[model samples]
Target: MDIAAIKEQLPIREVLQHYNLYPDKQNRLRCPFHDDSTPSLQVYYKTQTAYCFSSNCATHGKSMDVIDFIMYLEKCSKHEAIEKAKTLIGGDNQLQRLTRQAVLTKMFSYFKNAVYNSKPAQEYLQARCIDYRQTEVGYNAGQFHHGTRKDEALIKSCIEHGLLNDVGNKSRTGDTAYNVFGKWCIVFALKDSSNHVSGLYFRSTLNNQDQRHFYLKDRSGLYPKYPATDTKKLILTESIIDAATLLQIPAIASQYSVLALYGTNGFTQEHQAAIQSLTQLEEIIFWLNADQPGAEATSKHAIALQSLYTKARISCVKMPQGEDINSMAQAHDNMDVFIDLLEQRTADFSFSIEKENNNAGEQQEKAKLFIERGAPKQPTKTPPPITTGELDSTNPYKLRYERDTVNYYIQGGLPKTTDNMKIMLVIEDKASTQKARNRIDLYEDKQVEKLCKEAGEKLSLPAATLQADLYRLTDLLEQLIEKQLQQARPPEQALPVLTAKEREALQQFASKPKLIKRLNELLGKAGIVGEERNRIFLLIIAISHKTADTLHALIQG
Candidate 1:
């Protein structure tokens, strides 16, 4: 096939319209390619392409590519896609070659005559609350006779405008038959910016059973007419009624040119290009329905305009809840408030860091709980308590006990138990409680001094404090375990190396009580309360020795 001929025969505008590839200035349509929470997919008439820049999906392509993309989305073949495209375009592929000018001329003559002569068509427009006089067309009730007695002046005008052609025969019901029939239509000339007729729109009477009323016929390659000055702003709405309603708004009329899409689904690349071609527009306001689809389409169209002209300001004119522009205009005599609503529009894009943080925090909490419930079991054992007089200066038990008590108190634990232990030492021995307390205090103060010096080199003040407390607790516990090993004297002959389980139990008896108590006190200071603190402490105890060792290695590292 000749590519040039195919391109010429295939109207790009019509193809885009067929695939619903019009810029949704209102951001209303869900992107067909992916599950998008917002409409970021932009369709443009100037470039004849659609693209999505939002993070949701990467869809960008020409009109034909859009169809192919839709096919992929539907999981269908190209042939099937074309068939669907044909249905959407509202015509078969063969009809594309037919001269639209010829069709318009023939159809208009028939419709103009019917509108002037038929009582039913007149009543239909009136019943729908449409004022036919504003269209500047003549209407005569006597021109619709079935035979030769038909009004000659109406017939002559119809023929001259190329709005009628003689069919072979009259209907048996006695109505005059014609090659083109517009029994229920209101025909009008659609002009361009140059005030020349470019197309004809045949709108059917309101009472017709078929809701499909409007038909467009291009006059050669002429552009659609818009009633805006080169430098003025323009407001685009979805329907003719909406356009008229908006025009009646004094503020909108004073500041902008208004036009309608004619229907919700009437958007086409030709229409988009025509609007964009207006070089004088500083901004374009999309006055669309305030529903989901309308909002989505508005955003898409806004993106398209932004892509074309970096400086172009796009805004949306939102309608009141459950009310369209036409209805709202009829209800209120003033348009100032409506225009104010448009001026106050805001950009519709945002990111939520708080939401992300909440999600991550919830996941961490869940994992912690799961580990607590699924931890492996361990055994426990008891050790001999140290006597007052036997607690010699070089005895490891005495040194370890004093060190552990001081470590616990410095790490935010209560000093009650450690004070009691010191008092018991003084009463049972000749040593003074104050002297023993001062000794333990001096030892803890020296350890803290060393920790603070190390932490100061590595962290900020708050972080350093936290590090010092953790380090002090760990060092005291390790010293206590060493003391337990010396005092236990497991058989003295070293008969056999202790099993991993026995070794772990011995280590626990040496260090577990003090560590658990310190951890519980730290939890309380951190605002953990009641059953929660108890649960967390129990969970720590239930952890396997191997797991605890791994955790300790991590913390120390």
Candidate 2:
């Protein structure tokens, strides 16, 4: 049998995808034979050849055929790797199907339940303007460890079902799942072209957005799409939540089919096959995130799929810069903004890949055609915390903004549109006391005034208007933060770590009760109280080998 003939039958692009590898602008992958972050490996689309260019790599700047990649990844002899490659000739392997079924039945259930029971989870959805009832997405109560014995057991069960790694009980120790999915997250279900749920996707709600998304360990290239949709128009976005948001809009309901890629960088051969299967499709609209990566991915996807769907008109809808469909929908409270984005397109900027040079030249042409359209304009509303980089950072102070979307439900007296308001929280240590304690004094009058002043200036509001909104927002934050403070702990994570000198000072004061009492009084005078002040006092006591003056200086530092 001809090895070349067998290799020719394999779709090299798809094969690379199995290892979660994708081509960059140059149609190149990171060499699998080395620890490479950059695209050190080049895959020539025209010649159907690949090579690792990094001279230091194990591949040693040598060229390779697809079979060599199979051998490298599978850790098998050339003939064995060839035989193994033959079995992957079809789509959605057996393990992928079995694990997907198990995860769907078990993992999705936990998250779907979490939507109703968890406050942070619910707040996260509300903040995105997503009513849990409006979508099929799943939620996880971010405080998975702190919950009851039942919660711990449920998470462990995920390991049993192969939803998580086979690391046993360690998967419950907060690091295992959080390492893969991030602190707290919501899971989105992925479906096949037939629209059957076959995999789970995760998006962190606890500000770990960089960890962004995760797939079932055994993903079968099954993605999520509304199976009921075949409206001749399909909108593709970066996430399932965005897709669900589009479908929820009355103006958009049933008008177009919607689906989400895992993200801008995420694409697979199965997705390409699904796109190719749409002979009846008349339009494919790209509705990606309003960021640089999203735009580039949209351009590439549109250009690639356009060739396969020759009969369809492919266009990319513009999300306002820094605003995704979730934020855009929440801002407009309807489909007007989405329709605006779709209507803004004037031409087919798709690039045709010339047969002569299918690598750099084709990509450069694609970029050239797409970039000519110009950048997305700045959005009108206050961008989400995730977009502004506020939520993504470590908020040791637990500083964040909370909003009360006043009109979530359409009751007899309520309007259909949600009255979304943004309120800034001003609490240095509200973590230890969100409830049962008076918190109004914790917020300074000047601080509240300053926040309102900024908001008013940004929106060009009259003083009187600002005052009225300010009163509402202040009262809302007071109520919201006060309620949540009940659940807040001492915030041990927020306290600063002691330096070597500080440790020495603390060691000196450890044996002196009188010194500890005096330092506590000094800390109180400095306006530090509660858990933070106590922690500082303890730090001094633990390292009492230094004098009181030294300890005091260390504390001040």
* Highest lDDT against the true fold, candidate: 2
**CA lDDT for candidate 2:** 0.57
Q: Candidate 2's residue-wise lDDT over 427-448, tens digit each?
A: 2112332211111221356644
**Alpha-carbon RMSD to native, per candidate:** 35.1, 27.9
What residue runs in model 1 are displaced by over 4 Å at the alpha carbon?
1-169, 172-176, 179-182, 186-188, 218-224, 227-229, 333-337, 347-557
Candidate with maximal TM-score: 2
In every candidate, how many clashes are there?
21, 17
Write candidate 1's Cα lDDT for 515-553 as tens digits: 767666777778777876555645575565547353222
* Candidate 2 colliding pairs, count: 17
